[model samples]
Target chain A: MATHLILRKILDTGFVSEPPPAADPALRTREQDLQEEILKVFGQALTVRHVDAGSCNGCELEIHALQGAHYNIEGIGVKFAASPRHADVLLVTGPVSRNLEVALKRTYEATPEPKWVVAVGECGCNGGLFGESYASCGRVANVIPVDVEVPGCPPTPVALLQGILAAVSR
Target chain B: MRIGDNEWPLEQRPGCTPVWRGRVPAERLPALAHDVRGCGGQLTALWGSDDRHLGGGFAIHVAFGIPQGTAWVSSDLGAEAPAYPDLSAVFPQADRMQRAAFDLLGIVASGAVDARRWLRHGAWPEDAWPLRRDFDAATRFEPTLDAYPFIQVEGDGVHEIPVGPIHAGTIEPGHFRFSVIGDRILKLEERLGYTHKGIEKRFEGMTAEEGARLAGRVSGDSHVAFAWACCMALESAAGSPPPARAQWLRALFLERERVANHLGDLGYLGNDVAFGIGFMQFWRLKEEWLRLNARLFGHRYLFDRVVPGGVACDLPAGAQAALTDQCDVVAMHVRQLKEIYDEHAGIQDRFVATGIVKPELAARLGLTGLAGRASGQAVDARVDAPCPPYDQVKVAIVTHDHGDVAARAEVRFGEVFESLRLIQELVRRMPAGPLLAELPTAAAGAEGLGRVEGWRGEVLVALRMGADGRLERVHAHDPSWQNWPVMEPGVLGNIVPDFPLINKSFNLSYSGQDL
Candidate 1:
């Protein structure tokens, strides 16, 4: 995990200096550097389609936040495509709701081959607080194939950007 | 059968009684429906509430609205079994609404077609309505699927495309069944209720104040609307008016909530049309605004800040000023984004003339809120049935002549300015006094209706007191119920790719409808 840096550095520091590269080519940025580096291995431009099985909109807010100027995932060639057919990455959120399970499966089915599924919240990963909801089938992974899991009550925008970048790099 | 103003049979009505009182007979339902339809009223919400406290009987409440006033009709069924007349024959959209009523309350809509379970799965026994009074809160059940009969769309080259209750993004659950030929959608059917939180069933025995708190959580984004409606019902039942300051505070919060969701949705709609840059810019500004919500209101989504009687916490003087400054910043940024969106021809091409819903169709379908307004069905509760602070201040409603994806987008953008203006006016004219007053002891058998304008549209809540002076049952209806079914017609003639932009333009709340 990246070290906690409060707003003081962002608000107070006049300018930022890049951190030095790690001793190894892999395991360099923070947790799982090798995983992060692998995202860059697949050079083809990536398009992501986002699906919400039944999110509280907490993670949706942050996932949407990644497009903001501060994070700017688009600058790194990560784009949100409207339909799964054009997507290389299928970004899923929320616990899998019984009502939405079939729709989620179809969304994946619509996407072309060589697609990767990324579960994008604690609920998506493991159903979180609403885990026991009768309407919720289970976690997103239980209903679909998830290659990368982004965990947090709501992962911060920076964390989401890092996760997406990691996927593209891999 | 005609009563004062509303035509309801006096005899055979659910008299105000202890335990479970005030339930109308099931036989009177068809008359009530005919009366409302004759008056050109719309079925606002239809859901069942548990009356386990009154024994095993569960009550189903049907609320309808005219231009200004709202009428409520409720019936009680056995604790083990409940039934209601089907309105889908009159109101085509009531099919799913009735299924939802069946899912939680276990009420069977007699002679109702398309009886697929709305929220309940094979996980729970059919005899067990999760929203029933005796259902254990901690009980866990696995999902079980029954036969879901999909209506076949037949023709040359016609095929079915079934989508999820589980999706790729962080959104509520719903299934999209499309019968398409080529890229053209011949018919589109949506199956929702995956996020049914059992909100109505959970309200059993809770004090009015406690129930209002849970109401706010129904859909996190529309906190003010749900909270205000619940509080209004409680206040009306208790005959306690919120303090002047609380009313003003509620107005401010409501406007902020409206602006924030509209902003986020507008950005996503634009993004769906392939306007990536527009999405990035608008969403960035929206995030900054929400961060300010966290600062000024405590929670990022402004959850729990709105409680019954009044707000849970008062705003510090500094926080008020900070909110004003942020509004100014957002206004400036929004104007810039608007310019880009308006001038971008490619984006405009994709949005304009797609998902066209004629004005007459909108009225017949009972469309409410922005979707209704875009199609010229102007029925904002804040304007018609003014309450509290809104009654004191004039609410400017924005309407559009064309009811298409573009019109919806334009309506939302226009509301952005109106909401910001409302925020400024509210802050400058905030009244002095306490936020809340002591709630009155609600009389047994008293009934009250609460209507608030949520960002999506008008949110209506109705409550009836039992003979024991507790909430017999309550109905919280989101505008989505009226709008979700309309998406089918809206997507017709438009290509499949255009559906996303059109869908985002509507941005209906699934949880709101599911509950």
Candidate 2:
């Protein structure tokens, strides 16, 4: 009965298509050339390592949304790596806290060179609500150099995917 | 009334929770705690305040939850001494609270077993206390980089493993030191405060309305709960309550928050156990739920939805119908997924008997919320101390006696179903009225307390008005403070590999606790 139910459900919800390719008129030619160059240099795949430098976890939730069936980031050439050494880009979230400042710097240094750092969420971009304080050091740029900044309280999955593409293309 | 032969006069405050405020002699503080315990009181929270400007010297406040209401016991330690007898011997949880009090406000809890720094991680000098009036928030100090002395375990084949403050996944920072042998954990110690953002110190100059925004950000996932609690406290202080429609909307948001969190957790739990299909399915469902939230509420996580006097947004026309339809669809899909998850052999093998927290142990640790319910500690604020809309509707408290990973998962499933039902009822019967209420200016020095049962557990906020209607003090207590310590015992006997599964089952908030 269980197997039959699973089979029936799968058949009913058959063939969820992969997300359509990125199409922005402003960056169409540039992105296409960048995608080709990236494929030639690092193959068609890019591995990312995510770090949370004292966020409210809102941004992390949106980051997790990138892996949902609708986004299906894995269907493309992007995958989340378990360590910085294996990563081609680092996705950092939240306003960098004073306590995690050293850790963030160390994680950035540990990632292999020619790496990109994409700061996600408003907190990561400009320290959102929790700006500079005795306990917090401020935005991601305050501690480490960030390549791409995705600004939102918690950016949408589509925004996150675009940010990822922007980081990889860079 | 007399508490253990001590005649301490008490004054009752009318707010969300039944609060009795009284003063006791500094020496009798431990005795008062003991008496309260003997009277079946649980130590809810202990906080310290510097009232030198008010000529009240330093003050320590302890909240105890009894069957009738919450009793707030206060003792003023003169500025000369600034010390009180510790209550850690009576309530083990008070040990950390006392240390934190000392670290921040310089109020010494004399006789505390562990006097080591709790929150003051050498960010400032040894004598500098941030909470004191004289201390400045802009002061910068070079990192001391002093090593924390963790207690060592000495035995054959016993080794220590230190993990994180930085983890492999996109999780918050918190260090865990485990004493283990052959992959079996003998002892586990947690070092948090890595995410402390000076939230309490920053609340000094903000008004109650401004402080609500900070409260909501204390833990992003439980924004509605924290914001509602803050609003309750502020409204009570201002002698203004939101309209009936506003209360119903708050409940709706709270229920939606509950469902969203449970959906994500269920999926994460599946992924932890290597069940990719379950992860994908549950996450897909969660995405749909979030999309519905955005369509209805205009924000995915419902941020800034609940303000001081009422909710920020109202349900648009025909939105209720759309919500009802989505709820029906989610319920059907969730039911099917539950069947598949239950029948799956691998999930059961990983979930069934792992991470057991006995009921007695759970009660002793003062565990509450979803994890507490999983372990048979059925203390739901909606049922025990109902507020507004919850008072009108009946809530079924879900529990399991097994106290394992499977039990926690089942409790989450059951809660999601309940939340869906509550959402339907709340949306269908929402009263039509003004959404916002005009809040009167709070009297200077007026104090209020707010308590809301968030999806995680009870969220308590204590507010005091300063001159010009500014906030004097705002302390937001998350349930994670009580639940984090219990997580150590939950994972003691389990192998190291299963730690992630057990940890996720509890899923305590590091930022909430650190704040």
Number of the top-ranking candidate, with TM-score as the measure: 2
lDDT of 1 by residue, B1-515 (tens): 34324645333212111011134787667666666677676777777777667555777777666543555667877766568778877666677778877877678888887788766655466766677656775465654565566788998999988875654454566779999999999999887766665556556556776677667756656878888888877777776667778888888888988988898888788778776656656666677777787776775666666666777667776876787777787787777667667777777888889999999888778877999999998778788767768877788889997999889989988899888888887887888888777776788756666778899988877776765556756777788888998998889978887877788889888877776
Per-residue lDDT tens digits of candidate 2, residues B1-515? 55544565768777655677788888987777777767655677888888999988999988776555667778888886699998878877787778888888889988888888877665677788888888888777776784678889889999999999889787788899999998999999988888877788888989767899889989888999999999998988997889999999999999989998899999999999998766777888888889888988899989888998998899988899988888898899889989988988888999999999989888777777899899998788888778888889778999998999999999999999999999999999999999999788898888888888899988888877999989988888888888888888888889999999999988889889777
lDDT of 2 at A82: 79
lDDT of 1 at B43: 74
Which candidate leads the pack in lDDT? 2
Docking class of 2: medium
What DockQ does candidate 2 have relative to the true complex? 0.64
Sort candidate 1 into its docking category.
Answer: incorrect
Worst 10 residues of 2 chain B by lDDT: B1-10
* DockQ measured for candidate 1: 0.23
Q: Scored by CA lDDT, what does every candidate get?
A: 0.72, 0.84
The CA lDDT at A143 in model 1 is 86
